[model samples]
Target: MRDGPAPGASAPTQTDMDLDLAPSPPRVEDLIAARRAKRQAILAKYSNGTSSTSTPVASQSSQAPLPALLIAEQSITRANSVAMSVDGTPAPEKYSQGERRASMSNSPPPLSAQDTAGDIGADLDKLDAADNLAFELAKGDEQDGMQAPDQETISKLEGGHDQISAADYDPSRDRREDEHKRLLGEVPHKPKVEDVMEIEEIEDVEEEDVDDMFAVAMGEPSKKTKKVKKTVSKPAPVLITTTALLDTAADAEGYYSVILGEQIDGGRYQVVSSLGKGMFANVVRGLVLQSPPEAEGILGAEVGKEVAIKIVRSQESMYRAGLKEAQILQKIRQADPDDKKHLVRLERTFEHRGHLCLVFESMSMNLRDVVKRFGKDVGLNISAVRTYAHQLFLALSLLKKLNIMHADIKPDNILVNERKNLLKLCDLGSASDASENDITPYLVSRFYRAPEIILGVPYDPALDIWSVGCTLYELYTGKILFPGRSNNQMLLLMMELKGRFNTKMIKKAKFQDAYFDEMGGFESVERDKVTGADVIRKIHLAKPTRDLRARLMPPTSVKMNDNEAKLLTSFIDLLDKCLALDPSRRITPREALSHPFIRG
Candidate 1:
C-alpha cells in the first residue's frame, strides 16, 4: 500500500502491527486503583507477618511507573510496626478503601505538570506520619533504657524515600518541641524590683563604715541614710601626732587621711615622717620595705632606705597631673641614666587608696633651707654661689636640650644632699614643654618670675635663665633682689632696676592694655586702702639709682681685695646677660655656662 517497502526494509509483521497500534493511555482512575492495591498488599504483608508480592499495573504508553508509592507504602508499614512494638499493642486496622478514596478526592491538586505529582504529595504526607511514629518509638526506647537507632540507620531510611516537600516533612519539628519543653523547665523566676532594691540597700549599709561625728568635724557630709536604723556611737578622735590630727576617713575633697608610722602599698613602704604638703599633693618620708629588682643602681632601693613619697590627692584633676609628672620624670630619667645632670630622680610610682604616690630620692634640704641655715641675711659665700650656680646651669642646659621648661624654679624647688656639696633641681609638677604656647603667666615665684611672663608674652627656655639669675643673686646676697607684693608692683620694681621695657616688647604683650597705655607708657591699677576703690596709677621711668655692680658691693659691706673684686665684676656681668629685659637678648644656658663667672 506504501510502495511495498524500501530495498533493505523487512515486510510488516504481526508484532510490528501490534507495536504501531499502541494501547490507549492508562486512565487516572486505573492508576489510582493500582496504587491503592499496592499499598493494601504492603500493609497486609506487614500485618500477617508474611511475604506478599504486589504486581503494579504497567502503563502501555510512555508514562514511567511511580516507585515512590511502593517506598511510601513500605515506610508506612514499618512505622505501624514500630508503633506497635513501642507500645506493646497492635496497630489499628488498615484504612477502609472508601475513606482512602474520599481523602484522595478531597486533597488539593498538585501545582506541577507531572502526572505523579499527587502521588508524590501523598507519599510525602505518609512519610511525615512515619517520621512522627519513629520519633515516638525513639522516645519510648529512651524511657525503656534501650539504645535508640543510630544516625546512620535513620539516614538510610531517609535516603530510601524520594525528595519530600519541605512543607510536608520537617525533621527538626520534634527536636524543637523537645528543646522548648526543656527551656520551660529551666526558666528562672524573675526577681521583683523591691527585692533588688533591698539587696542594694543592704550592700550600701555594709559599706558605710565612716564615723558620722568625725565626718561632720572634718567638714565632710555624712553618708548615713534614714534606712540605716542601727545607731553608731561617736568614738574619740584618734590622735597620731602632736602637731598632726589624723582623720578617720577620706575627706569630701578626696584627700586620703594618713597615719604616722603606718605601712602602705601592701607594706612595701612605711611612713616615717611628714616632708611637706602642696596644693596638688602631700610629701612624706617613707622607708622602703621591698625594693624592686629594677632599682639595682637607682637610689632609694635598699630596705630601710629613706625615700620621699609624694601622694597626690585623689581628686580627678590632681590624679591626672600626677600622671603627667610621672611621665615627664620617666622621660628625664631615661635621658640621664648616669644621674650626672643635677636633676632629681624619680625612683618609682604606685597607687595607694585611690591616691597616686611618686617615690623620689630623699635629699637633706632644699636651697631655701640652705640659705636659711648657712646664708642667713648676708647670703652664702661667693665660692659657694659659684659652685651652686655651675650645677644649676648644667641642669638648665639639660632641660634646654630636652625642650622642657621648669615652670616653677624657686629656691624651695632646688635640693641639696646631706653633704651640701651637690645641688639638684626638683618639683617638676608644674613643668611643661618649652615649645608649647598658651602657658599661664603666673609661673615661677614672684621674685624670680621673668618680665616676659609679667607682660603676658609667649616665653621660652630663656625664662628659666631669668629665674636662675634671681636665684643666684639671692644665694650671693642673702636677699631677694626684687620682692614685689603684687604683679603691678613687681613690674615697677623691675623698671626701677633694669629700666623701662622696650616699646616693641609692650606691643607684643597680650596684657599690654593692663600694664601700658595706648601711647606705650606704663600704667597700673591699684586698690586704694582708704576707700577700697580701684585707682589707676601711671609710672614715670628714672635711671637706676645704683648700677648692678654698685648694688652688689655696698659701702657697708666688707671691702674685697683686687682679685675678689675682679671675680665680683665678672659675676655681675653674667647676671646682666641673664636678666635681659627682652627674651631674645637673654643668654642661653650653654652660653651662661661658658661665661667668665662660671668658668672662673
Candidate 2:
C-alpha cells in the first residue's frame, strides 16, 4: 500500500493504467492436490519395496499426469543435493531424519534414481523402482540396522490395509525393461563355428584355376621371384593379331614411365617423355618387357613385348576425356584379341607417371590429318573412296560388337598404321555403352554436326554416321557440305539443300531471329502461334555457306576432278541422309557402315 495516494495521484483518468493482483489460476491448486495424491499412492503401492527377479511394473494409467509430477521432481532434486552435501559424499539410505538438521532440514529422505524415474514419468519410474529395490534388499541383508525391503517385500506387506507404510516405488525400472523386450526380441548372438565352415566349403576350388586367376591379377614377377618360384614365362608375339581397319600408333624406340601420380616414390606411374600427345591423352613408345609364366615361349621373339604405351591423361580436367577413351579401348580389346579385326585392342593397362596407361600397337598418322593434307580431290575416284570406306566399315563392325561408339569419329581420330596394314577407329570421349541412355553428344565440329542436332532433334549413334559422311565428303571434294560458322547456320545451309524453311523444323529449333527463311514471302509472314515473340524468317547464314556452295557447284576447281565430283555428290547424298530433317529417317552407324560408298 503506497503511503496515502499522493496528491498528484489525483482522480484517475480513462487513459490511466490500473492494476488488480488476483490469486493464481485454480488449476495450480488442482495440480498441487494431484501431486499430494500421487505421493500417497507411492507410499501405498511400494509399502514393502522388495523383489527377486525384475518383474515389470504395472500401472493404472497409460500416461502419467504432468505438472504435478514436475513439482515432485523439483522437490526430489533439491533433497538429493542437500543429502549429498551433508554426508560430504552421498546420502545413506538408513540416515536418521532428526540428525539431518545440521545440513539437510528435518525433511524426507532424498529421492534416488527410482524417485527421479517416477518424476521422469511412468516408464522410467518403474525402472528406477526395480533397481533401487534390488539395491535396498541387498543392503538389508548385509546390515544389522533396520533397512527397507526390496519391491518383492510387497507380497509380505498384505493385510492391515489401513496400516500406513512409507516405502517408495518408481514405476520406471520395470516398465522400461518390459517395453524394451516387447519392442525388440532377445539380443542377437554371434554366429558359431558351423556357419564359418559352410562359407569356407563353398569357396574351395581347383588349384590350377586358382593359380591362373592369381597369375592374371599379379603381373610377371621380377627375376628373383621367378627364380624362387622356379616358374618359366613364355613370350607372345608383338602383334597378337592384325586388322586392316586399325592403325597402331606404337613407336619402337623404347618406353619409360613418364609421370608418377602424386609423389615420385609412390602412387601411379604415368609416361611423360617420349610421349606423344593425341586428341586427348598422352602416349608413350615402349616395348613388351616380360611375359607371364603361362605366356612364356608361347610365341617367338616378335611376341616378347615391344609395344606402345597410351597414357590416358591423369589430370582431372581431362579425366572424362581420358576415362571414356580408356574404357572404349579396354572394351574393344576384350571383344576380339587375336583377330584385331575390330576396334583397337588394349594389350593391357599399367601405371606410368601416376596415370593408368593403355598398351596398343602404334600408328604413324591419323586418317583425317592425312586425307586433309595429302588427299587429292581429283584422285578421289569411286574406287579410292571405296578403299577408305571399306576399312572404316570393318572398324565400325568391330566397334558395334563391343557396344562402343566412336563419338568423336572425326577423320583425325581415325588412324591407319601403313606399315602394319591396319586401320583403327579411336577416340570415345563422349561415348559410352549405348545402353546407358545418355547421348554421346554434339561435340563434333560444327560442320560435322548431324542434321538432328542442328535442328534440336534427339539423336544417338546416328550422329556418328553424320560425322562419317562429313569425313567422306571432305575426302572427296576437300570441301565441307554445310560449312557454317556455327550449328545454327549449319542447319540453315542444310535447309537450303531442301529449298525451303521447314516450319516444323523451325518450331523444333526454337530459334529467335536466327532461322533463315527461304520461303518467298518471308518478310510479310507473321506467326500466329507464337506470342510475345518475334517471328523471324530471314537469317543471314554465315559466309562459309557461300564458299561451300561454290565448291559444291558442278564442274568445280581443278583440285577436284570430275571423278572426285561424282564421288563427292554421292557422299553428299550420304550426308543428306545423315542430316535428314526427320530424326527417324536419319542413317545409323551400323547402316552407314554398309553403304556401298564406304564398304569394301
Local accuracy of candidate 1 as per-residue lDDT tens digits, 170-287: 2233323322333233221222333322211212322223522212122223432222111111222332211111332345545557789999888989999887766557789889
Q: Best candidate, TM-score-wise?
A: 1
Scored against the true structure, residue 492 in model 1 reaches a CA lDDT of 72
Q: TM-scores for all candidates?
A: 0.57, 0.44
Would you list the C-alpha lDDT of every candidate in the order shown? 0.61, 0.42
lDDT for each residue of candidate 2 in 283-360, tens digit (9 for 90 to 100): 655544444344366552233344456655444434455566676766665554444343555554545444456666
lDDT of 1 at 290: 83
- Candidate 1: segments with Cα more than 4 A from true spot: 1-254, 293-300, 526-534, 556-558
Give lDDT: candidate 1, residue 311. 87
Worst 10 residues of 1 by lDDT: 137-146
Q: What value does the lDDT take at residue 92 in candidate 2?
A: 42
Global CA lDDT computed for model 2: 0.42
- Among all windows of ten consecutive residues in candidate 2, which has the lowest summed lDDT? 223-232
